[model samples]
Target chain A: TQLLEQSPQFLSIQEGENLTVYCNSSSVFSSLQWYRQEPGEGPVLLVTVVTGGEVKKLKRLTFQFGDARKDSSLHITAAQPGDTGLYLCAGPFNFGNEKLTFGTGTRLTIIP
Target chain B: GAGVSQTPSNKVTEKGKYVELRCDPISGHTALYWYRQSLGQGPEFLIYFQGTGAADDSGLPNDRFFAVRPEGSVSTLKIQRTERGDSAVYLCASSLSLAGATQYFGPGTRLTVL
Candidate 1:
């Protein structure tokens, strides 16, 4: 089974703080995506990184794909209360299948 | 619908009972997916449907779980003899195609098996 492990399962920081979350896997993936989910809601896609060593920024959120395509990172700059939520990383396998494997997740709480 | 829609935002049922969760994918989306998320964890893929056929169902934990997309637009997930472990949020998502396409997710149905 392919497993994606995420670090810092729970994070709590004051507003305006900067934090980073990491997702790592031993198996290579064809593409990776980042999502943010609020309480009692499905996750919303933030960004998708398909190429190795690729970086994409969305407002205060920056996502980076590892050079090997086996890992990814999400960094939030000057975080606010709105940034508080559960973050998840997902990737599809290389066999042309539609199934996606998701990481455990990171719950972030930004206190104002 | 504007996006994927799931019925019964929250369902509470007793153990050994049967439950069905419904999902309505976006119009023209050919690929639909089902996932389960336990508290404090990310969503785990349960099944994938390409049109009316199940392309992949390896993620299903047991035979008690079954899903069908009869018309390719709406899908249903049925769980028989529900167990406490079946308590979680069942999410449905759809994409134009699964090949490198972003999936649009529904609000999900929270099923609590007591």
Candidate 2:
């Protein structure tokens, strides 16, 4: 089974602090996606990284894909209370199947 | 709707009762997906539909769960003889196409099987 294990299952940090969440897997994926979900709401896509060693930034958030495509990371700079939410990483089984295997998830809380 | 929409934001039913969750995808979107999310966990894929046909249903846990998208725009998920373990949020998502496209998610339907 292709499983994505996320580290630091829960995080609580003060505003302006920096934090990083990791997603690792034993199986290689063709692409990786990050999502943020609020309480009582479905997850919303944050970013998708396809190439190995590629990095993408969205405002204060930075995402990186490992060289082997078996892992990924999300780093938040100067975190704010608004950045608190559950972060998940997902990737497809291969090129043909559209189904996604999701990470265990990281619950982040930015205390103001 | 501008984005995916789900009905009956919350449902509470006794165990052994049947339940149905609905999902309306964005207009012109041909791919629809269903996922189940339990407390403190990420959403798990349950089914995926490409148009009116289910391209993949391998993620479904058991035969008691079934879904259909007859017209290719809306879909319904039915659970038979529901158990307490079925309590969770059922999420719906849609994309313009199945390949290499971003998915937009609905608010989700929270089902509590008592």
The best candidate by TM-score is: 2
Q: What ranges in model 1 sit over 4 Å off?
A: none
What docking class should model 1 receive?
medium
The runs of at least 3 residues in candidate 2 whose Cα sits more than 4 Å from the true structure, single-residue gaps closed, are none
Q: Say which docking band candidate 2 falls in.
A: high
TM-score of chain A of each: 0.97, 0.98
Every model's TM-score: 0.97, 0.98
Instruction: Give the TM-score of candidate 2 (chain A).
Output: 0.98
Best by DockQ: 2
- The ten-residue window of minimal lDDT in model 2 chain A covers A93-102
- For residue B3, model 1's alpha carbon misses the true position, in angstroms, by 1.3
Candidate 2 structure quality by residue, lDDT tens digits, B1-114:
588899999999999999999999999999999999999888899999999999999989999999999999999999999999999999999998847788899999999999
DockQ of each: 0.80, 0.82
Model 1: how far residue A64 lies from native, Å: 1.0
- Give the per-residue lDDT of model 2 (tens digit) for A36-60: 9999788899999999999999999
